[model samples]
Target: MMQAVIDRIVEGKHAVVLIGEDEVEKIVPIELISDNVNEGDWIEIKIDNDGNIISIEQDTQSTKGTKQRVKNKMELLRKRSKRNK
Candidate 1:
């Protein structure tokens, strides 16, 4: 199959999507898909006979977020950890 950029990946909450060309769409409960594959990366996906993502391959260049965003999330995680302690 021609490799398609993950136009979007919506997990949990019914878990279906209508993909558009050359645009952005929000994939919900992104964690589920992320857990199965890697979050924020283009994956080699295979649609099964049932039309589900039955397979995936990692594309390292597809990492999500600007450096600032990653830093902010790490900061938030650190703050939360400190609070838990």
Candidate 2:
């Protein structure tokens, strides 16, 4: 299984994903994806031995936690910037 973020979706065709820390881009067919997937959503993908997508699912819990952390950090930064100004 590999973890990735949905960078973008090419309508009914495919989805562009960003993988790993370096953010390697990969294009996967939309057919292999679970329903309601959207850009910036974190996902877990299973690839078969033949290099095909066996399964893909959104990591809702992880995504929520990460988003909350980012939001908190941004708020802190905003407050600090206001104090400095």
Candidate 3:
């Protein structure tokens, strides 16, 4: 299993996924993933020896943590901008 985030859906057919700590982007056929998933949602994917995706599921806990981190960073940026202005 690998940790990934759904970055975006392209043309309604493929999903752009950012995988693991390195954030390597992989294009996935939308059908292989669960429908409840959306952009920025965290997911766990199971791949075979051939690098084929066999299973994927939404991971709520990771998503929440990631979102909180992003939100905090955005807030920090905003505060710095106010001081610079």
Candidate 4:
């Protein structure tokens, strides 16, 4: 297991991850993992006995009120759309 930075998402199944000073392009089932991961984010990846990256855990900041943020974004979008009409 090592720390890596997500670079470019080539497709739904593959992405280029930068580990240390080397970038390894791996075909992983990232779709099986959580969508919380994004480009430029740091994650801990583990390769199983099959030599496949089986699990990925992102290093994220803990925050409260996620529901409030979504509501606010929706409200802002609604207001913008109304003004455009």
TM-score per candidate, chains pooled: 0.32, 0.80, 0.82, 0.53
Q: Which structure among the candidates has the greatest TM-score?
A: 3
**Higher-scoring candidate on TM-score, 2 or 4:** 2
- Colliding residue pairs in candidate 4: none
Better of 1 and 2 by TM-score: 2
Q: Pairing residues by index, what is the TM-score of model 3?
A: 0.82
Comparing 1 and 4 on TM-score, the stronger one = 4
Q: Give the C-alpha lDDT of model 1.
A: 0.46
How much is 61 displaced in model 1, in angstroms?
Answer: 4.8
Instruction: Give candidate 2 regions above 4 Å deviation.
Output: none
Extract clashing residue pairs from model 2: none
Model 1 lDDT per residue over 1-85, tens place: 3233444444443222222244323343443344544323454445566655555444445434334577899999999999999
On residues 12-56, what C-alpha lDDT tens digit does candidate 3 reach at each position?
Answer: 899999988999888999998888889999999887888778889
Candidate 4: tens digits of C-alpha lDDT, residues 1-85: 7666677677667666776446665555567446877666666777777767767777553112444676799999999999999
lDDT of each: 0.46, 0.85, 0.91, 0.66
Model 2: per-residue Cα lDDT over 1-85, one tens digit each: 7889998999679999887788778899888777787778899977778766778888898788878999999999999999999
Count of steric clashes across candidates, in order: 0, 0, 0, 0
Best by lDDT: 3
Q: Residue 2: error of model 2 in Å?
A: 1.8
